[model samples]
Target: MMKTRVCACQTKDVYLPERARVVASEPMTATERFLAFELESGRPLGHQPGQFVEVSVPGVGEAPISISSSPTRGAAFEMVVRKVGNVSRAMHELKPGDPVGIRGPFGTSFPVGGAMKGQDVLFVCGGIGLVPVRSAIQYVLDHRKDYGHATILFGTRTPAERLFVAEAAEWARAPRATYMETVDRGDGQWTGSVGVITTLLPKVTIQPAKTVAVICGPPIMYKFVILELRRMGLSDDRMYVSLERHMKCGVGKCGHCQINGLYVCQDGPVFRFADVAQIREAI
Candidate 1:
């Protein structure tokens, strides 16, 4: 009989030092925008869903934006931006030919390979939250055979505030994905559901144990939506979210993006509910 020795070693972190050029920039809606960039080496970003990239402009600064495109989409990657602050505002002014620095498709990704394999996924998004969740949603849709069912629930302040309207419409039309959207207030022209994002939760049917819930949104939206998910019997470990704060240096050295001991730039922009539930400032 042979005795097995268990050894533990820290995983060597890999950082992407590559530069990517913006191939196109288009308006997804009045407030939301999309930028497509191709790596200089022409290789795909090779990131899992729910991971984010640190986008930098030399004199301006850098911001953490989620990967909005799926890996199945080829060598290029896309980010959906909602022009909320200075860095995002500067990003909106960039053109197709502009150059930007990219470091990481980093942090923990949604547990797609774990709970999501052959299980249903419920994507709950609000405002710009759709940006990160879109990456995972698209991945599941692209690899439909590996998953069971997918439900996407999105909400915004108004019709004009809706991000990725065209893509949302297209996803709604896809047979494999169920898409539903709502707005807080609507103009007379709007026909979709009108209420806070939490309202959409009760309308959907999901098996808590067999479902993985991914949520991302503004700070306020997270609190309310998370409460609803908990009421639905979704375990804290099965719920995932992405956090956003001002990020100066993508590396952990800069304290500008810290949430207590966790650096938003390094430890996360994505964290499991089980991990962040104890951090007071995390929400």
Candidate 2:
């Protein structure tokens, strides 16, 4: 695998954005929209998985959205936006061929190499948490022969709420991949496991010492899931998590995304469990 380059130092203003045209937009769920774009500059968005970009709408303002597609996928980048506020609501109104301002592919990313090299990988995602986690998952899949066993455990509130249904189906069928899914509750048509994601852990075979796990979800879910991971004999250093917080600025200048001494926008959206454990209030 080629080494992913860190972005070049910007001599010009970083706040200024380049023009980008929306190439596709579709509904992923009632609240979420999947959007793809390509820069007018014709440059590849060389972003690593777990990083995010600050998307702007001129008048509607900008918000940091995680890049959902792997950099290895294509020249176009993707984002999954949930309509919860003005900026995201405006984003929901966007369509193919529309133009928008693009700021950055900022922040830290998952350690797909070095520390994680040659280890069994277990991806644990909850709800929309899969959005960012999907990037890293795809990177692993793209270079399938480079890694060991890969197991994915995804959970949602209900069956209909599942995201990337088609892609997940394909991953389930991929060679050397173990995919399992669960829901907190099931509708009449549901036939899969019906329970919280933690319940699925006991059903999978994992080597706690040789495995590296990445988890992303709501704060409440993180607490319980991490507890279960601990119970499974996984050490804190071997586990990683992606965190979410209010991030007014994509860089560390703004304090909104601060978690104790770390900035989620700069230091991490992804962090090792050993470091986060030092902050009592962090999940």
TM-score of 2: 0.95
Provide the overall lDDT of each model, using Cα atoms, as 2-decimal numbers. Answer: 0.84, 0.90
TM-score of each: 0.89, 0.95
Best by lDDT: 2
The number of residue pairs in model 2 that clash at the backbone is 0
How do the residues 1-283 of candidate 2 rate in per-residue lDDT, one tens digit apiece? 9998666544667778788989999999988899999998889988999999888887999888999999999999999999998999999999998999888888889888655678889999999999999999999999888778899999999998899999999899988899999999999999999999999999988898889999998788898888899999999999999999876787788899999888898888999989889896577
Predicted structure 1, TM vs. truth? 0.89
Q: Scored by Cα lDDT, where does model 2 land?
A: 0.90
What's the CA RMSD of model 2 in angstroms? 5.4
Tens digit per residue, CA lDDT, model 1, 57-102: 7677777788888888888899988887777888888799888888
